[model samples]
Target: MSKEENAIIARKLSKRFPRKVFPRLEYFDVLRDVSFSIKKGERVALIGSNGSGKTTLLKTMATIYLPDSGDLLINGYDVYKHAEKIASHTTLISPALDFQKKLTLRQTLRFFHSIQAPYGELDIALDFLKRMHMEYLLDKRLESFSEGQKAITRIAIGMMKNPDIFFLDEITTGLDVNRKEDLVDFLKENISSEQTIVMVDHDPLIVERICDSYILLSRGVVVKQGRAKDIGKELAYKYEVMVIMKDRPEFDEIVMLFPDQADDVLIDGHVVYFRAEDEDELYSIIERLRLNRETITKYVVSLVDLSNIYHALKPETINEIRTVEDEKGLPERTPTFDELQEIIRLFGIMIDTKSGVKIPPRKLP
Candidate 1:
């Protein structure tokens, strides 16, 4: 409701990466004038397609990637001016941790923990690692660990920080069913309501377990954001009916049949997806397709999921972002490889984990 009540405030935030594509270096814009405010203590899911800038926005907000222009305020601190401060309070756990270094798991965890909490207790963190059944790998080199082991170790290290803001990027990647469920349950029970969690997870279980709200991104733009239940209302639908046809000969005919629901029809090869606002609508669509069973393969119907939301979003142009940057007199220059490395090193050096309590924090009452 107010500035003080917000945990993150991003205004006109934009970021781009220089890609060495064949003949010349091409500038690819990842985030374009993205603006949104996340309320304090909200467990919000950042939903978007593969290349929709979800990770970029999360890293930028956590002060990992410096924005070329625009302002980002997290927990009342200007990210640019307070990048070091923000890094201390925020912990970003990403797949980048999937390294095959020669160091053992124990050595890696100790190194990171000492960087943040030199006097903290490692036994507490180890106890939680035991819960994930990864304690046996403590002495094993990272090179010998499986993808799942590396992923679990990363989670253990990141959680050791006990940051005020936890940023999870594809957290469910490489995790097994039992361990994934255990980690989610432990976090849901331990993380206090005052501590914010911003995650990008595709697994329905994670979203259903923790996410109360979401921010949907489409091609580097803030397309939609609100409470989780509000997404269905935005699309004017409750359930999704995906009809798999042997051949899409009836695709155009189906579209013509429901001209009023033209926008709701999303065609992917032989699969035609339909939005049903209610049971009656869902029933009608299903029956109509059954008449053409000779041309149909099968059908699938379920509640609206994040992937469905991403597909339904219309992409926007980046010309407006370019025009705004030109008006602001922002110069377009790519940071050198060395400069980028130095920037990251500075981020590492500036992080102050001294304020954190012991790892594997006690459950808050």
Candidate 2:
């Protein structure tokens, strides 16, 4: 309700990049009227496919890039007008950040600490380095560190700041399973409700464990924003089970058992492929057929998750989910495969023929 109550607020935020194609300049939309607010102390995740503007949005919020047009407020202060003030309360940990490669781990911490107090505290940094099992490499130059080591180092530096709000952009890029687990443990122990965090991470397990909410972006727009658990349950809970039976095994009877849960049933050769909305539903089907376990030659269940949701969601449906209605409107819906082909033919971009794809007239010799 109040500025102090909100950690970040964006209104009609849009970003564009000019790309030159041949003789024409086309403005590529990176973020289009994307608007959302983060309550103070909320740990929210920003997720989407590659090139979905997650990084751009994070950079904009961190004051690294000014928006083409729109108002972006950080901790109740306008990002552009009060960048210096905001910097005091916010810290961003991203791979895009530049560092002196020649600087040793300890030196890097000292350099960043000079700019932001408490971030380079000797005691804190040393403690974190020890916990990361990296104290032994304190003298190692950044250029000599492995990618995972570099990630851990950057995270250590970020944790030292203990800012009011933290922005993370793909900080888990190079972490191994153990390192990732350690990072998650550290975040859980350190991040409290008194501090806010906006992280651009794709690992669903990590996200679900740390974040209370999420913002789903598509084609540079906020497609959905809600409780992380709820969204995950709604879109990521299903599982696909493929079973091979000694005989056909009554395909019609399996559907009867799961009247509502089982769907997309198909007998491809001898493999029966279908989907169950949840584990319980899948179990229900299994129980009904338990008496004939020997008849089931083989079976496989594939869990669906945020990745599945990303692939299944149409662009229009994504826009509708977030209900984005502002001056900067939704993108034009994508054309179907057939419709796209027709358009290409009309514009001579290329032509699909029986034998092969024909080159555009402009490229024809």
Candidate 3:
């Protein structure tokens, strides 16, 4: 392919990390001969389970780490040989704690501008702050800002430089619903036809919403690459429906409202239905049911339901479903306790990785 046609290109790019404690410890392969090309103006999402090399690939594209083998080029600039030139046109928003705590938002931005452009281009910085709804917090010390505030500030700083390629590593962490929506709006508005964006997030929901394309990584390899909408459609075939109830009151009410549907309901678990149209109708029904101020706490329509998808997609994942014959000899399995725990954990991880929901670690007895 022509160099001018590609925004970023990786040809068999790979990375290896040496182990710390032994004379001959095995080198960990963080990335393995991954090759893909991103086009200008395309919004691509890199998704995987933890340790699947999404961050490593992004860092390599950002020229933070040189590939152990193969080649990576950003806008025709060799990532290894043209690190400085690539740095000029690429920006990476990592999770590293690098901001100055003592400096206020405005002061910090000014400092970054001095280093990045140095020619007095504070207008873009100011505009970004304004777009983030963070202009009012400009004078507040970075140390005093909340996690969400810090995240927004970092994003604003990254955008100020107007890099040709933007690599976002879960940049929406710690943001509230309103702030998240605002940031998404800003991204949609400012993304130019000449710029490229690559994002990594565990939550497919967020990825599906923002990205036009997706690359699914598993065990340091690209397992699937295609349009995001196509992947969603494939996942929908295997997903089970979930009806969440807050307590016994809501559960009882749900049963009373739809007795026939209740028979298939797994009570706090997910149910599989073959028809997408029925699922849509069920979602609407649930919403209307909640409109009456009924004691319904929460209702959700999951496309693939995380647990089922994880097990179906990842060979390493353990399946919890056991086949049993019903009264008519139809086979089914009740979702087990372990399955519920895994599903909840997977959901939490996806949310935290995508939105920075800091869930505390589970306590072990």
Candidate 4:
């Protein structure tokens, strides 16, 4: 497809933040020369481990964050130059979006609806809430509602704008079963064919069901890309065979036996995992182990899932994702997106914190 056919494009985009290294200041790169594109109306999933910059990349694409280097174009317009216009066309839903706990759901919806939509649009937003079965809780204080109720409320408020592009950052994580069903029903019925959705979700089942393609990120870089069914081939069959053995010898043997399907086979120390795409494939793998059960300590045939992908993307040497608890003095990384927004609200001014300098506003086209 041509460049004009794409909804969003990132070319060698890079972003970094300043960090204190005891005696001096150092820079930590969050995004490193990232490049990717999403066609208009396509549903795409951002897959990655912790601290892989998935959230940061999503924020950049939504124009909530800007690239320090390279170009990001949304609908053929430079995001850095037309940030506001691009952002207005997209709505991001995540756990970071919080409502006032003291207010009733009715009051909260009206308050944000007045800001994001016209008077008549309130009914449309209410319709979504009703579909989610959250209208009954409208008079209840937000603080008393369950996390699942809060989840749907966020989407309802976000949809008030009727954005063209939806950017979801792990929106389904904390939802209860009933609420999750409601959200799924909403996605299936409410979303239009022409609207685009970019999401960051850990559940491979949801990703495969909702997304057409996926971009896998690792340490702030695109490590892999493929069709959604390639999520360990979960669409064909839902079984995984994990054989416990020793050394690369078994790993090599399995690879040799299943040369064509080697990509579905993976080994990490004492465990060898086989991602079966079908029942025949699942039994074949188990049958192979049965033939050599004397040498095989044991093997298990369970449901195929996203664990292999996560293991593949696991950092080779990284210890762990640092958090606020990791810092004894100042934060290890820059303030989070919510923190920065709060700062801008209360302080009347905020800096990027990368260079400790105020950023000039971008001019609208």
Candidate 5:
């Protein structure tokens, strides 16, 4: 590819932080020799566990943190050498940073437009706000807004910049179902063939819907990288398989194949588990089971669902989960979108319980 077509390039990039104590403890290397390239118009997801260095890599790319070694270039400009010029075309949006709580929504957006484009494209900013359903909150101070509202506002402001490259860090953390769907639709509509977006998220559904490619990070290293579909397929192959049963087969067969790894599968109202060396082996067993089809009720590959993936990658938060469950008991009536909201809330609480990282509760105006 031509040099200009390469929107982002990092070669052996690394970052380290020194100890804060007086004795000067060991230097903690958050990122170690990480490198990757993102082409123009490509949407890529960065997936990893917490403390895997996804945020550190993004900060370095955004020029918020300088790499201790190696080089990072964005649109032909070295991120370290041309931080100001790069900022003109690059925007970073994350819950942890990028918004002014004291400013009213409209005022903060106007200020961002003035600083980024200077000519004050107020019309464009207002248009975007209206599109995001934030016009009603335009006059309210950001501090008074809910977490979901703030997240949506940040997205709208980022869109106003019409950045050539956008970096998103856990941007979907607190959004409700409707708002989340709206933001996803907005991303689909606005992300053009000329812009590059790098997203860091634990949400596989988001990755499945929006990302063209994915890079799996573990301990600050890229363990796998490929098209999003391919990654999903590979994960399915590695983790799940179709099963056929005849006359309500004994549970031992299922348990023996999967052993400890079969928690994801359910069959005939009973949890089933199995494991094979690979996809081929798993399929082979299925084929044999299907030959006797007299007793098979249903068969489908049981892959790791998004929630399972999230929990697998992150440490479990037992206390937070119990607290959320305790507060929001199982609904006695038919479940609705409101119930889904409560579930997501409980999920976040569970994460907090284990990690001690609180995900601020979201509210509505």
Candidate 6:
């Protein structure tokens, strides 16, 4: 690929921090010989446990933290030598960003515009504020804004730059569900095929929604890197499908028909449950069930999501995504879009949960 097509390139990158105490200076290695590349227009996620050097790597790429050794390039430009060229096309938004506490959001935007010359006019910045739903807070000082508002303002400022490359680190941490959804929608609508985005986020839902590929880091080492679906398969997210038929004989008939495809099949009265390795296999089974529409009454299916992948990859740190509990302490449930798609793809097997006609066995005249 051409140099412009290569958004980021890191070769044997390493970084170390020096600690001084009394008469001695000691060095601690944060990243060691890390190497990776991200193509332009690819939304790549940087994932790892805390202190795994995810943030350190991002900062180094953005030139906030210089690597002690090795070459780092943005659009084929040497990070140290062509830093200004890199900055012209890139914007970094991190929770660690410090702003002038005394300045209002409007003043901050003006100052940033003066320094970076992001937009020739203030109108663009105002438009971004409106998009972020923060136009009302434009006059509010940074000290008066809540943590979430501050994050929104920072994101607004970053968006105003119209960057070709976005380097984001924990930018969604303080956002509520509504604001998060809005941000996700905004990204989906605005992030075009010409832009490159690198994000560091702990929320798997956000990562799965925004990133097309992932670079998994463990203890400053590259552990895995690939497309999202391949990574999902490598993690082995299985699906369990259960079909309830109008009669027990239909369940037995299905078991007899696809004994090879269905294993560990169990029959509880008129219900049958089977497992599939992945969605492809599940789709095949659902096709067969559709052919046997006369027998099936209702069905339910469950599969793994991004959260499951996170659990399998970082069981030590990731927490389970739990549905809220009712007053009686029973968990409530709602299907995510991914889960709903799986359900609808396999929705053929499900006749209806209540009061639906079952097509009787075909009669050859």
lDDT of each: 0.71, 0.70, 0.65, 0.69, 0.65, 0.70
Which candidate leads in lDDT? Answer: 1
Model 4 spans with C-alpha error above 4 angstroms: 21-25, 118-120, 229-273, 276-281, 286-308, 311-365
What C-alpha lDDT does candidate 5 achieve relative to the native structure? 0.65
Q: List ranges where model 1 is wrong by over 4 Å.
A: 17-28, 98-100, 118-124, 202-205, 241-274, 285-302, 305-307, 311-365
TM-score of decoy 6: 0.69
lDDT per residue (tens digit) for residues 318-346 in model 4? 11222222344433443454654454434
Could you give candidate 3's per-residue lDDT for residues 1-365 as a string of tens digits?
67788898888777888755476665666776678888887889886778778898998888878899998989899887899988888889866746979988878988988888743357766876787778999898999988888888888878887888899999888888888888787887877878889998655555656788867675565645656455434442322444444445444555566554543333323322211235565565555556633544555455543233333333332121122335754332323435434553554322223222122211111
| Residue 200, model 5, lDDT | 89
User: Which regions of candidate 3 deviate over 4 angstroms?
Assistant: 118-121, 232-242, 246-365
What lDDT does model 6 reach?
Answer: 0.70
- Which parts of model 2 have CA positions greater than 4 angstroms off? 21-26, 118-122, 232-282, 288-365
CA-only RMSD, every prediction = 12.9, 10.8, 10.7, 13.4, 13.9, 14.3
lDDT of 6 at 225: 65
Alpha-carbon shift of residue 214 in model 5 (angstroms): 1.3
Per-model TM-score, in order, reads 0.70, 0.71, 0.70, 0.68, 0.69, 0.69
Candidate 5 C-alpha error for residue 275, in Å: 8.6
- Cα deviation at 241, candidate 5, in Å, is 7.4
Q: Tens-digit lDDT track for model 1 on 168-250?
A: 99877998898889888878876788889899987755775788788867557675567766555444468888778787645
lDDT of 6 by residue, 1-365 (tens): 76767899888887888756558876666676778889999999988777768999988887777789889998888987988887887889999996887899989988887877844346656875677688988788899888888898788777777777899998898999988888898887877889899999989889889998888675565645667655435432366566787887554466576655544354556766555666787887788777777778987776644433454443232212222345864433333435433442342211222322111111111
